[model samples]
Target chain A: MNVGLLDADVYGPSIPHLFGIKQKPDIADNNKINPILKAGVNLMSMGFLIDEGRPVIWRGPMLSKALFQMTYGVNWCFNDRELDILIIDTPPGTGDIHLTLATKYLIDGVIFVTTPQLLAVKDTIKSIEMFSELGIPIIGIVENMSYFLESTGLKKDVFGKNKTKLAELECLARIPLMESIAQAEYIDNSIFSLKDCFSELAFAVKTFIEN
Target chain B: MNVGLLDADVYGPSIPHLFGIKQKPDIADNNKINPILKAGVNLMSMGFLIDEGRPVIWRGPMLSKALFQMTYGVNWCFNDRELDILIIDTPPGTGDIHLTLATKYLIDGVIFVTTPQLLAVKDTIKSIEMFSELGIPIIGIVENMSYFLESTGLKKDVFGKNKTKLAELECLARIPLMESIAQAEYIDNSIFSLKDCFSELAFAVKTFIEN
Candidate 1:
């Protein structure tokens, strides 16, 4: 799949680390930058623009501009053909980054990631509500760190119950906390490693996209 | 102490839930919003402004305004005397909300809350970097959900090592996951309930502030 990922998380961009990219993207035509290609996906992040250890202490106005620049400023298309999918890694909250993206782009839907903790779940519900209010479609919810498996193979709900109205409201994927999954080694310049850790998740995502 | 709390987390204001305030704050003279007094501490939150179950779907600009209104627009003083201290409950991340507060206010210092997990620690590092760059002093770091205590009074580091250099960098307080702490009850508008959950934390904060 011709996938593209934009790390809209200007403050703490982790896409570069996730993709293991150190070199910056090249400047394409019209001062637009080309995204770094890894495996079968094109990735871009603000992490490439600034030095590591420097904080992006920008106010609201500045952040909005940067977010706009990152989205509309870059050259994300190729030869008049757009990417099959563009996944934006946004910071947690139901504010600026979300509102900006939802308003400025044609988002198909949004997937919410949350731990099973009540505090995290409560905030996520607010986030879901915000997205719905913005008229965005609820893609699904993924419960991360849902449970841990013991040596006896007994599944333990570490964070707490996945008892949320989210499952009733939409499709919910409960991703357990596995040591192997958490400690997955990324193969050199390959997406296979991610698939190993998220085989079930990838399958679910594929089903969602296909249907 | 004449303390004040502002729930700058407009999207999911949990101060109301945490403090268990059901009624709204009253509007004082010159359109200054009077904070709801609770156990000697004055509190204000967006949760008090809006109805339950509704989301604050505001853009960056609107959020800046709301944050400004919540901080400067409100009367955070008693009998013409300014509050001794005003604690702002910010959402996670170094995004618009953090930037807005950091830029607008002469914040003395910032306290970071994080789990011992690498993911949470990574984000907290970014937040710390942001605060440092903004010239906000690092008060200290509070490690929440640090451990799970067994029935036999054994403490297990479920998420693993408190591996961050935060202690070497700043004062660090590790808060254990205790049933008594979590299940602390809010009694008759008394903030003492929270003291049960955060007595050590409160003492650490007080020491940091005094120093």
Candidate 2:
């Protein structure tokens, strides 16, 4: 059965609730994840989530095993009958975990996450290089928490909007960021409902995975 | 609270069960864990047990996060009772996970797991160097599953027939493997007649953590 191996760290906000199953005792304590998904979709959140307070000092093997357990140990149910997708929420790094995930798992594609800032773009570029060497499909990049819109309705590109520049470095299908996903609620739940939608990105991921 | 992290991984087939805990799961499930000891003697199991089948592609961030969740998360009951000790099951290499455990956590001592086998010895040397670089105090290495003895009084050092040579590479406390370990019933329950008797190694670890 095809499955998704999600990675959750302190770097990002809680995953928006998806549907089908209720929250288990393992995740009951967290105020982050959403309650349930719609009828068809089911999400199984795995691995330790870093809270805002404590410092997380993890290296590699630990990270790799947890993900493996999440796949092998956790009871995962994929909606698609012939599902074969395992999308991992990898941290921004060319470190050990990233290397192992790319090399070990015959991953169909990678949806790299980053911000619109220069540093994030720079790191994402490095990420592309590392994965490219491993011959992993560079599906696209998700530019999260892009820019801040002041109360005065004036939008400032705090991180210097550089989506186009990033997509140039890699053949990215979609560059979703501040303008599209500036809100927190939408992201935490993986909701996609914008007038000028990034359906293109989501579709790209869907087509890439399904193909 | 004086608490020490014990490497739960150092399980011997002959050693009697200590503190009423099984060394490993009898019938292995996907989530195979080398039992965790509660507060008093927090012995953490180190190293991965591979099944003859699928590949064991551990040693990454997922692995590291699992260790953190196991160490810091979970019901790791420890209070400020003054420092006692924390010994981790270190992999036999300068792998990233080992390095993080050495540098990130409050590790007082380390016990290397090695076999008489040339391969194990080679990897153990690398492990020592990695630990040394992190500046963590290594109590000593323990030659594991060292030799095999038959009921007919025949002794074989099949694993590491060449002894002392491995010890010279890194001074260690040798633990010979007992043939009785082959008894499946004893192993399934792990109720060994002669429980863990590594007094010298225990003494070294205790001295390091308490001091």
Highest TM-score scorer: 1
Query: Number of the top candidate by lDDT?
Result: 1
Off by over 4 Å in 1: A72-82, A150-154, A178-197, B75-82, B150-154, B177-197
What DockQ does each candidate score versus the true complex, computed on alpha carbons?
Answer: 0.38, 0.05
* Per-residue accuracy of model 2 over B145-168 as CA lDDT, tens digit each: 555444444554545355436545
User: Once superposed on the true structure, which residue ranges of model 2 sit more than 4 Å away at CA?
Assistant: A1-5, A8-13, A16-22, A25-40, A47-59, A78-80, A150-153, A163-196, A209-211, B1-211
Residue A74 in model 2: shift from native, Å?
3.7
lDDT tens per residue, model 1, A69-150:
7877778884355888888878777666787777887888788887766656677888888888879877777787777566
Candidate 2: residue A202 lDDT (0-100): 58
Deviation (Å) of B82 in candidate 2: 32
**Each model's lDDT:** 0.72, 0.47
Model 1, C-alpha of B125: deviation from truth (Å): 3.3
Candidate 1, residue A199: how far the Cα is off, in Å: 3.9
What fraction of native interface contacts is shared by candidate 2? 0.12
For candidate 1, report its TM-score: 0.83
